[model samples]
Target chain A: MYEGVVQDLIDELGRFPGVGPKSAQRIAFHLLNSDPADINRLREVLGKVAEGVTFCEVCGTVAEQQRCRICRDERRDATLVCVVEEPKDVLAVERTGEFKGRYHVLGGALDPLSGIGPDQLRMRELLARIGTDEITEVILATDPNTEGEATATYLVRMLRDFPGLTVTRLASGLPMGGDLEFADELTLGRALSGRRAL
Target chain B: MYEGVVQDLIDELGRFPGVGPKSAQRIAFHLLNSDPADINRLREVLGKVAEGVTFCEVCGTVAEQQRCRICRDERRDATLVCVVEEPKDVLAVERTGEFKGRYHVLGGALDPLSGIGPDQLRMRELLARIGTDEITEVILATDPNTEGEATATYLVRMLRDFPGLTVTRLASGLPMGGDLEFADELTLGRALSGRRAL
Candidate 1:
């Protein structure tokens, strides 16, 4: 352990996801040698984040203004909304350049054991959007894990009441550059079941 | 990329050593969900480090007071001093429970290519301590790398001028519990050359 604030800094940094004790020590020492300007910049950024970084009122994704840039853009297809688990998912979908529609950030997927349910997510807001925004479709782009699948199933049941709303899920198959021989059983099973004519 | 302060926070976190872009993104989102108090604590620690973390005036290691804990302890042998490259090195040696003497942190080893020389380190302070503090033995415990070896050689030449001062260097050989077969030629040769009659 180090003296005073240096050790304190290491302990604090270790709390971040994926940062082990050794990594925390390395980062702390690097910061110790960093310029005051650089350290102040990090502190200022953290201060801003702690002071309540704005989330889009409509989509629930982090935003600068009242809504996210995607929500603000007129060219985005508002009628075709993409339902995602978090703001990071929005970025991942956006990177593909295949999603031109707006997004509805669910904050997190369903995990009852972890005390996360529909009430914990933005399911009510999503229903509200479908009812009032003249939405034609909602793409369920949650992760392929248990919690994400549960959230999708719950959303499907809740959304069945609405008419003429097409619900789709992101395809699950072999990754673009993956080798079939090395594919896992679950992924290969999914690919075989969801095979396309093409 | 994210928008507003969220993106700024991610960018700032990426500046830390070993935090790549994806890791930076993950850390940013983790911090976004972390309790406000946790984030505040990190900010406060960085603030203290930026405001100028105190260093031991005598040994040049990070300290809470005018001197380090080892330096302040009256039971510690002031007649003996272990020389190290950094404060972290001091901790490494202290963990062995063998060295009960105080330490003199050199901050860094000699690396002329990086424009660091004897003046850049605590060479003058070390010399002054030998002259006035009546120190009997000085142990050179810098790293085993090229820069550390150069520093030890320079210090050896400089400390030879002292009449009764006994200067020593750490033994070089294969690490404990390490396989002799896997040991490099350099280490194997050092162990052979420095053989003892046990």
Candidate 2:
């Protein structure tokens, strides 16, 4: 039962992924009471991103230029490419500070039930990128989910015939934080099945 | 580390009141992937509000013109004014559909420690509004918290001598939803002290 514009604002804020009605109301009113200058700054940035940002032509990560910094930097290891489902996945892997390689975003995972197939992805572009002599190994670093696994499997089948190309799926096991007793049977089985010679 | 613009967008999203690092990252990336049309709409509305919305000159609620809709409506009971601390409080009281009267927004609660005093509030404007011929009663409906109580007490004292003005404070009691056993001692004491003979 709020005023029209206020209700509109609350409804819009609630459409965001995790923001519920109560939170949306709180945020909307907070914005209503806040100084216009601060709110304008946020609006400006959002507008700029929508207008200026685009997916990297080389890797599909968000960028203002043709290629993302990771793809453009000459110092990055061109021999190693980490394949992932979405641009956000690229950030998740980068946060660990362990991988110093380039990335190739697949736009989305393969979900056959939803009618998504290999042709919908940037498979041809990835194949062309790999055709260059600089790349030696491709790391399948997609999420450890069913769709991600299916996408990785599809990529493996498509790229297997390329001579001298070594394809490897990232390892899955008990999480660093996990309790063995609480682990599900399938996960425990996978942990056992994928055991390494320690 | 991400490309500079992605990092900038993440930082900007994080500036919202309750959003944390992971949430900010997710929203930033969602915006990155979302249809540019939707992002443009949000930006347009935000810009519109920033440029056009203003405080009602009469009651201090958010408005697009000189007065808020409630105040501008001739049918509303101008004789009774429900005084509240913030614009959001006005919306909450309105949602009940119980108050037939209009509202007087105090901008914020009284907090001497925070350097907010009676002089900083809209008390003078409230007095001016009440002194007019049509007004009959003033209802103090500030929140039950310490700051709200202080503000209500200040209003009561200030309006004690107004001729023909019926000054009344909203009753303090156990909320309709609240468990009596879970209520704090002070609130329980108030509930017991204010008990009516049924």
Candidate 3:
């Protein structure tokens, strides 16, 4: 609905994930009104990220170099690996400061309807990492959704062949600080069944 | 929270209007996974918009040239002028297709706390336009919010000195297709007061 360059900018911004047409327009106008230096800086950063960022060769996580920071950090427990569905999930887990293990980003979870299968993910690379690395425990920390469960189930069945390797899934329960009354039935059921002796 | 260029991209994307930290990170990762050509295209468009777009000399609206399309169009009713807050407001009024008059963008409203007074806006330009042009009617089409109402009130008082000019404010009432039950008290009051005979 705008003229020339303004419309072009809006169209480009609309391509970003979660940026709808209204948001795209608002952003474009905001950029138009902002300092020229700020816009130039954004453009420069975008160009640099597009050219520099690449998937980690070992774990499929986003990296500026061959391997991601977690993979390169020798201090992290290499014996324990936490497997997640995407690079963002790695950040989510890391924020808790609970897991000292390395991560393996699967690129995506299993969704046959969307044409994403085990082969489409980094399953082969994961298997290779487990076989070669002295990984003692594998933590399946994928989402609690259906696709995540499916992917975890597939991985558990495959990992059964590796002797002396322990496999574990992240616990499912009412979130920390959440009210019991607000907990969904499925989550409440799981929390009740998985209750541990206090 | 990310490495090098990846974090830089997220920071830049976060600067955009309505994009929070999490959304910025998601957009950054999405761009990292997207084609290099797409990113380059976005960069090129941003550069073009920053370099090319300038405010219209006639009405203060964003334009590629000195004059906006509405000001340049000879067929538009020059005798009727509609006053609005920002360049975006011009687009909103235009979308309604109810008015064929030219526009005079006020740049902003009269916010006393923010130190934005009449002098800060394009009031001088608006008065100059009214003095020079054969404008028969001046419609105050500012927003329905507090600042917009203040601006409209200020303009109405200012325009009173000009003889042979019909100054009017846009009618305030319940929005079209909005349920009466959901309408706020102020809006319901305005709707009742402004009710027209069948």
Error of 3 at B186 (Å): 4.3
Chain B structural similarity as TM-score, candidate 2: 0.94
Task: State which candidate, 1 or 2, has the greater DockQ.
Answer: 1
Write down the C-alpha DockQ for each prediction: 0.83, 0.49, 0.65
Per-residue lDDT over B10-63 for candidate 2, one digit per residue giving the tens place of the 0 to 100 score = 887677778888888888878877787888878777776676567788888877
Q: In angstroms, how far off is B67's CA in candidate 3? A: 3.0
lDDT of prediction 3: 0.91
The residue ranges of model 3 lying beyond 4 angstroms of the native Cα positions read A178-185, B177-198
- For candidate 3, the docking band is medium
TM-score of 3: 0.90
Per-residue lDDT of model 3, residues B1-198, tens digit only: 876788888888888889999999888878888898999999999888767587899999988778989999999999999999988889999999999999999998999999999999999999999999999999999999999999999999999889899999899999999999999999999989999999
Candidate 1 vs candidate 2: which has greater TM-score?
1
For model 2 chain B, the run of ten residues with the poorest summed lDDT: B44-53
lDDT of 2 by residue, A1-198 (tens): 565566777777787878888888878877776788978888878877787676799998887678888888888888999999887788888889898889999888898888888888878889999997478899998878899888998899988998888999998889899899999887888899999997
Task: Write the residue-wise lDDT of candidate 1 on A1-198 in tens digits.
Answer: 788888898899999899999899899889899999999999999999898889999999999999889999999988999999999999999999988899999999999999998899999999888989979998999999999998898888888778999998889999999999999999999999999997
Predicted candidate 1 versus true structure: per-residue lDDT over B29-114, tens digit per residue = 99899888889999999999999888998999999898888889999999999999999899899899999888999999999999
Share of true Cα-Cα contacts across chains kept by each model: 0.79, 0.41, 0.73
Sliding window of 10 residues with minimal summed lDDT for model 2 chain A: A1-10
List candidate 1 segments past 4 Å from native: none
| Highest DockQ model number | 1
Indicate the worst ten consecutive residues by lDDT in candidate 1 chain A.
A153-162
